[model samples]
Target: MTCTLENHRAELASLLKPVFDSLGTQWLPVTSEQLCDRITSEDTFAVLPIPAFTNSQMDGYAVRSADLLSAAPDAPVSLPLGFTAAAGDPQLELQPGTASPVMTGAMIPAGADTVIPVEESATGTFPELVRCGHGTPSGQAAFTAPSPEGRFIRPAGVDLAAGALVAPAGTRLAPAMIAALASSGLTEIPVRRALKVALCTTGDELSNGQLAEGQIPDANSPMLAALLRRHQVEVRTIQLPDDPQGFVAAIDELQAEVDLIVTVGGISAGAYEVVRQALSPLGGNFHHVAIQPGGPQGYAQLGDATVLCFPGNPVSALLSAELFLVPLLREFNGLPEPRPGHYPLAAEASSPEHKHQVRRALIRDGQVTILDPGSHLVHDLARADALVHIPVGVTQLVAGQSIETWSMNV
Candidate 1:
C-alpha cells in the first residue's frame, strides 16, 4: 500500500518502539564529569545537600541578630571582632556580643543567626586587627543599622536537599544538570547505552578517492553518519558497489553487530537496484511514500537488525534521514523531538498536487523564503536553515501565507 508521510512515520515508530524499549533496560555507570548528553536509565537522588552546610552569601560579618537590635545612625553599637572566617576555614563559635568576619561561601559559625555585609559597617570593610592578648587579634565592628535574623545567610539544603531527585528516568542530562549532579556529591551516574548502527551507501559511480569521468564522491555516507552521531548513535559506514551478492554478504556480517542498518541508494526501481534485490527475499517491504525528494523508501527485519533504505540523490538521502531516521534515534536516546513551527512564506511557491513536498528554505527577517525544491540541489540544501513542508493537496501558496517548517539548526 502507498503510505502518506505521516503514515510512514507512524509505521516506523510502531516497528522500532519495542526494539528501543528493550534497549533502555540495559545501562552502564558513567562518571558525572562525562555525563553530558547521556540519558538517565533510572531516577537518581542527591547524596548530599547542595552546599552541604549553612554559609554566608557575601563577604560580611556574621553576628547574632540580638546584638544589633538597638543600634542606629545616632547610637551605633560597637562590638569586638573575633577571628576572620574565610571559605574552607573550620567552623568557629561566635563569642557573645561580638562579630566575626566571613567571606562569601564561608561556613556560618555557631550562635550566628545573621550576616551584615562589610559595606553596611562603619568602616565599609573588615577591620584590620592587631595582635592582642592570647595571640588573638583585637578589633571591633561598629554597626549603625539592625539586620533581621537569617539575612544574607544561605542555610543548608537551600538549593537542593539531600536525597532529593537529581534527575528522573529518561532525562537527557544537560550542562546545568551535570553541575547539579556534581554539587550533590555524585561521582557516577546510571545512563542508557548508546544505540549502534551500520550505514551502507551503494553506487557504482560513487568514489571517495580521485574520480574519473562520471564518478562522484560518496556524500551520503558522511552526511548520514554525522546526523546519526549527533543523536548519539555509534555508526560504522561501508561503501558498496552495485553487486547484490556483496551487499547481502555485508548485511549478514553486520546484522549481529548493529541495532539498525541504513542504506542509501540502490532501493529505487532501476536496472541496477542492489539493496532491494538482495533484501526483498528476506521480507523487506519496498514501496513509494507520498513525499517528494524521498518518495522511494523501504524497511525490513533482517536477522537481528532493522534495515532502512533511502533514495540515491544527495538531497533526497539527507532529507529522508532527517524525516525518517533522526526522530527515531532522538526518541531512543531520550532527547526532545524536533517540533515543527509555523512561518510565513516570503514569496509564492507551488508543490505537487498529491505528494507532500519539503523545500529547503531560509528564515530571514522573520519570514521563510523557499529555495529550490529539486532533490539533486545539494548546494542549495546547505544554505537552508529550515524545511518548509507543504502538505498533500497544497498545490499553491501565496506570499505572506503561513506554512509548517522544521528547524535544521539543531
Candidate 2:
C-alpha cells in the first residue's frame, strides 16, 4: 500500500521505537574541553554563577560610583590612584575617594561599584603609582562622570545564576555552550552515547570494476556517511551487488552491529530490485510515497536492526536521506527538530500534477530558485543548499510566490 510522507515517518518511528527504547538512556562522561557536538542527555544546571565573582568589564579604574558622580569630560574629577587590580588578583579593596587601576576581567575590589575605561579617563594609560605620582592624596587621576551604579562592572550571576538551568535536556553542546559550562567550572559533562548506523549501497555497477564500462561509482555511501557523521552518528558503509542472497547476507552481518541500516538502491519496481525481493518476504513495508525523486521507499525490521531503503538514483537517494532519515536520526540523538522554512521563488517553477515535488533549490537573500526542475541532475543538487517542496495539486508556482523549503546543510 502507498503511504503519505507523514504516514511513512510515523510508521518508521513506531517500528523503531522498541529498538531505540532497548538502547535506553546511556550517558558517557565527556571531557568538557573537547565536548563540541556532544548531545546532552539531561538538563545542565550552573553549579555556580558564571563569572563567580563580580569583575570589571574594561581596562580602567575601579572606583566607587559616587567618586565621579559630578565629574565631567571637560572638567574631570581627580582622585588619588590606589593599587592596580590585575586579573586573578585576590580580595583587594578600593580606598574611599580613590581610584584603583583595573585590567579587563579583573575582580572588582570590595568597595568598588563601577569601572571607568582608561580611554574615558583624562589619563588614557593605566597609571604606574610609583613613577606617575609617587604617593600621597595629591597623586590623583581624572575620570569621566560616573554614568550610573554598576557601570562596566559585570555583576556575579549576571550571565547565569547558581543552580540556574543553563541548558535544557537534548541540547547539542556547541562552542558557546562549552564556554558557558567551563565558566561554571564544569570539567566533564554527561553526554548521550552516539548512535551506530550501517550504510548499505547496492548496485552491480558499483560492486565490480565497471566504472571503465561507463558505470556509476558509489557516491551514496560517502555522502550518507558524511551526513550521518555531522550529527555525531557512527556509520559503517558497505557496497554490495544486485543479488538477493548477497543483500540478505550483508543485512545479517550488520544487523547485530548497528542501531539502523540504510540501504541505497534496489527498492524500486524494476526487475533487479534485490532489496525489495529480499526484505518483502520478511515483512518489509515498501511503498511509493507521495513525493517526487524519492517516491519509492521501504522500511523493515531485521533482527535487532531497523532498516530504511531509498531509490538507487544518486539524487533520489540523497533527497530521501535529507527528507526522511536525517530528521529521524537527529530526533533520536536529542537534537532540535528540523525547521521548515519558506522563501519566495526567484523564478517560475512547475511541479508534477499529483505528487509533492521536491526540487533542488538555491535559496539566497530570502528567495529560492529551483536548480533542477523535473530532472535528476546530481550536479544541480550539488549546487543547491536547500530543497523547494511544492505541495501536491499545485502544478504552477509563479515567481515571487512563497515556497516551503528544507535546508540541506542542516
Model 1: residues >4 Å from true position, as ranges? 24-34, 129-135, 337-346, 365-367
Q: Give TM per candidate.
A: 0.90, 0.78
**lDDT by candidate, in order shown:** 0.86, 0.80
lDDT of 2 by residue, 167-200 (tens): 7877878878887877886666777666788888
- Put down candidate 1 lDDT per residue, 1-410, tens digits, no spaces: 57899888987888787667766544443453336787888898999899889999999899999999999999999989888888887887898899988889989989999999999999897767422233585779999999999999999998999999999988888888887887898877878767778899998899989998999998888888988888877799988768889888888888888888888999888978999998898899999999998999999887688888889898999999899888888777767877788888899999999999988899999899999889888888888899988889989999998888888955
At residue 183, candidate 1 shows an lDDT of: 87
Clashes of each: 0, 0
TM-score, cand. 2: 0.78
Best of the candidates, TM-score: 1
What TM-score does candidate 1 reach? 0.90
> What is the model-wide C-alpha lDDT for candidate 2?
0.80
